[model samples]
Target: MTLDFDQICALLPHAYPFVLIDRAVEVVPGQSITALKNVTGTEPFVQGHFPRRALMPGVLMIEAAAQACCLMMLAGHPSPKPLYALGRVERFRFRSPVRPGDQLVVTAKADKVVSTAAIAEVVCRVGEVEVASGRLSFGQVGSA
Candidate 1:
């Protein structure tokens, strides 16, 4: 099932332009998720992130992927008390520039679930080619 940005906000704490994941394409409990972001020229970052050739930053790509992981985390846990954090990023790469009008798709696979933390393998892609991939770690901030 897909969750719109408002629903995403209901699930996650991120807001506004910082909420990189536009919507969740697929959400499976304790498994994996796929999310999407439609890049646009009107974004705040594009205004000054090189006005001549505005492009989405690579870090934002990772953030989007992380937000997808956040979605999956919320789907499984749903406690509303755990605050997600980025613990590590491995094997991440920015293959190409993400321009306006491009649709960024992020896929995340839940791999590890510890007593208080979870890890996921995440990939960010524009099409078939991967733009970034990494291992994302998240932890709960408080008790249920």
Candidate 2:
């Protein structure tokens, strides 16, 4: 299924300057998801990350991946709302720098899921180039 910006806004708790995923390109409930983020010079981080040559921060890349995984995990749930918390991030690697004007395609695939927690492998790419990748563990918080 495809999720547009409005749908994504409803699914995630993040807001402007923090909502990393721009759109859900593809989503397979309880399995996988692909999301996009259009990098731009106007982004707040660019102002200080490097005034001369702006680059997307590595941490934000992982945050984007984590958010994608959270969406993937929530897709199959009966209740549409639930807060997800990042429990762990492992084996993260950044192979290339993501710059302004780059369109990031982030994908997350489920590795395991239990009563309250789930794990997924995530990767971020700009076209054919892999920029970052890692595994993320998250869990439902409070009431569904």
* Best-fitting candidate, scored by TM-score: 2
Question: lDDT per residue, candidate 2, 1-144, as tens digits?
Answer: 888888887788888878998899899977899999999989999999998989999999999998888778776677756778999999999999999999999999999988688899999999999999999999989644
* Residue-level lDDT for 84 in candidate 1: 77
- Model 1 over residues 12-92: C-alpha lDDT tens digits? 777886989888878985689999999999999998887999999988888888888877877656455477777887778
Model 1, which residues run further than 4 Å from truth?
Answer: none
Q: Give TM per candidate.
A: 0.91, 0.95
| Worst lDDT 10-window in candidate 1 | 74-83
TM-score for candidate 1, residues paired by index: 0.91
lDDT of 2: 0.89
Point out where model 2 deviates above 4 Å.
none
lDDT accuracy of residue 143 in candidate 2: 47
lDDT of 1 at 90: 78
Residue pairs in candidate 2 whose N, alpha carbon or C atoms collide under 3 angstroms:
none
